[model samples]
Target: PFTLRDKGMKHMVGKNWRDLFDLVIVQAGKPNFFTDRRKPFRKLDEKGSLQWDKINQLEKGKIYKEGNLFDFLRLTGWRGSKVLYFGDHLYSDLADLMLRHGWRTGAIVPELETEIRIINTEQYMHSLTWQQALTGLLERMQMYQDAESKQVLLEWMKERQEIRSLTKNLFNPQFGSIFRTFHNPTYFSRRLVRFSDIYMASISCLLNYDVNFTFYPRRTPLQHEAPLWMDQLCTGCMKTPFLEEMVHIR
Candidate 1:
């Protein structure tokens, strides 16, 4: 599921585009592209610059505009999970393709590149380390009802809140990362998981692997199944579960 804009693409328009896929559709407005069956298909000129007459049949080496999915399936006989569609817009481009048509969806999340870079920074790692320490101290505070211990717990809680804000600000000063808001997944992240079979920074990432390569989704640890930070600390692994979660997100 590669985009036309990928610079590293081996097959491109006016190059080896014919060898790339069985059919190519441009300006096929979607989710309507999949939902609307009555929209007539139009032809694109040889240079792929201007629209021509209405087309009844699809042909290789030729470009088309605003084609319906009904005719596309009937003509090409491509349907279900075999058809892997790639798009940037989650709802507009991919939701209907996956949910309605049963096509495997690949989401092009360009923000992934920047988010990964920020996650790898020393500042982000340091904040996570301190946050884990504060969490452990706060858990122990429940056993202490003394005034002095309560005062110390309050101070630690304030510091923990500051660390949380700082960690969020590392990715963004406003909304934070699209994948997360603090430790929880953002609304966008939830939708991304629902709509897409897989996601990457760019469609060009497909070049890094073989065509037949199978990508298996990792089984995320449930809340009840998650090991405590104290257990991980005793095992000498200071890394947070969120770090491991991030690796599996893509």
Candidate 2:
């Protein structure tokens, strides 16, 4: 749940780092941390000093470094299937944790703010820019004016480019986001969909909702799954049933 993603990054808050967990492992070099033969746990001496000796077993509120996921679970008395890990990198954090460790995982993407704003403000702006012109073009196309249709189509493409650029610049003016490529998924996004079990804007995103809530994805019928010409289906509400696992923090 904590990491040193960058030098200045904050690792934890509102609690003593060592006191929060039965053990804390650092520099394990994940996703290798989960796969590699992990180094043993290091404990603090009675006088609040580092003890270089590595040992097995739980000494509550002690810190450790370079230990494997399975060993940590053994100390905590949980099997691999009972563990949950959260991370940010699509491949390094979420995918590798689930695939290698057999641990349930959550993805934390901090750039969702940019994507959300583009969906809201830029989408509205794009529609406003084209409404009158596209309406006129539709009328002209119906009249079979091939030459006018070609010119109007050019205008439509130009309008689309402007809005697309505007939104892309907000995330990365030079390269845009790894998750988006125009109207299609970027290559990173293609891989992301196959791996992540769940995703959110940030780690804090869950704090706003039921912590134990089990997420249920939309069960919409695809074109091939539904009767031809039905065109659409209601996927139903997003909430899960009887979320007894949900926790409330005071």
Best by TM-score: 1
Q: Rate the local accuracy (lDDT) of all candidates.
A: 0.77, 0.59
List the pairs of residues colliding in candidate 1: none
Query: What's the count of clashing pairs in each model shown?
Result: 0, 1
TM-score quality measure for candidate 1:
0.78
Alpha carbon deviation, residue 24, candidate 1 (Å): 2.0
lDDT of 1 by residue, 114-197 (tens): 999999888887778677666765774558989998898899789989999999998889888989998799999999999999
- TM-score of each prediction: 0.78, 0.65
TM-score of 2: 0.65
Instruction: Give the number of the best model, judged by lDDT.
Output: 1
User: Worst 10-residue stretch by lDDT in candidate 2?
Assistant: 241-250
